[model samples]
Target: MTDPSQPEDTDPDAEDGFYVLHLFVTGASLHSTRAIANLKQICESYIPGKYSLEVIDVYQQKALAEQEQLIALPLLIKRMPLPERRLVGDLSNTEKVLTGLGLSR
Candidate 1:
């Protein structure tokens, strides 16, 4: 379903549509590092050039973390393509991450 708050042109079904994703992680944590790699792999394989990923280390950017209300060690936020979504974990499950980001396998 399309989110009413989003612009009509922002179609989630469009293969060429752009996506803005923010990944927040705690500094130096193994899980955080893994999440970053997993997220990057998923984005490259799935969205390719149609997505922008921003990896933010909460330890370095504490203000951003607090502003985004990040309560998890590794958090992924889909900021674009309509209704926002979030997934928190090591991001090892590719299928789950894809689904959470509203993408198909």
Candidate 2:
């Protein structure tokens, strides 16, 4: 379903739809680094030119973290495609990440 808050033209199901993802991680921690790498790899492989990923460091961006209501070190939020989903982890597991992002095949 499409999110009511977003514009109708930004729908993820559109032929040229783009995913908007937010990844919040603690600065330079091992898990954070891994999450970044894993998420980037996944995005490149699965959604290549069709996604926009924003990486935010909680240590540096406390306000943004608070806005997202984060309660974990490394968090991934699928902000588009409606029914936003949040996953907390280093994102090392491909299958799990794919499923969480609704990209599992």
Identify the candidate with maximal TM-score: 1
Q: What overall lDDT, based on C-alpha atoms, would model 1 receive against the true structure?
A: 0.84
Backbone clashes in each candidate structure, one number apiece? 0, 0
Record all residue pairs in model 2 with backbone atoms less than 3 Å apart, i.e. clashing: none
Residue-wise C-alpha lDDT for candidate 1, range 4-54, written one tens digit per residue: 965454354645668899999988799999999999998898889999999
- Candidate 2 lowest-lDDT run of ten: 7-16
Clashing pairs in 1: none
Clashes of 1: 0
Prediction 1 TM-score vs. true: 0.84
Write the residue-wise lDDT of candidate 2 on 23-97 in tens digits: 999899999999999999998998899889999988888888888788887999988765577899999999998
lDDT for every model? 0.84, 0.83
Estimate the TM-score of every prediction: 0.84, 0.83
Error in Å for residue 28 of model 2 = 0.3
| Prediction 2 global C-alpha lDDT | 0.83
Candidate 2 ranges with C-alpha deviation above 4 Å: 1-16
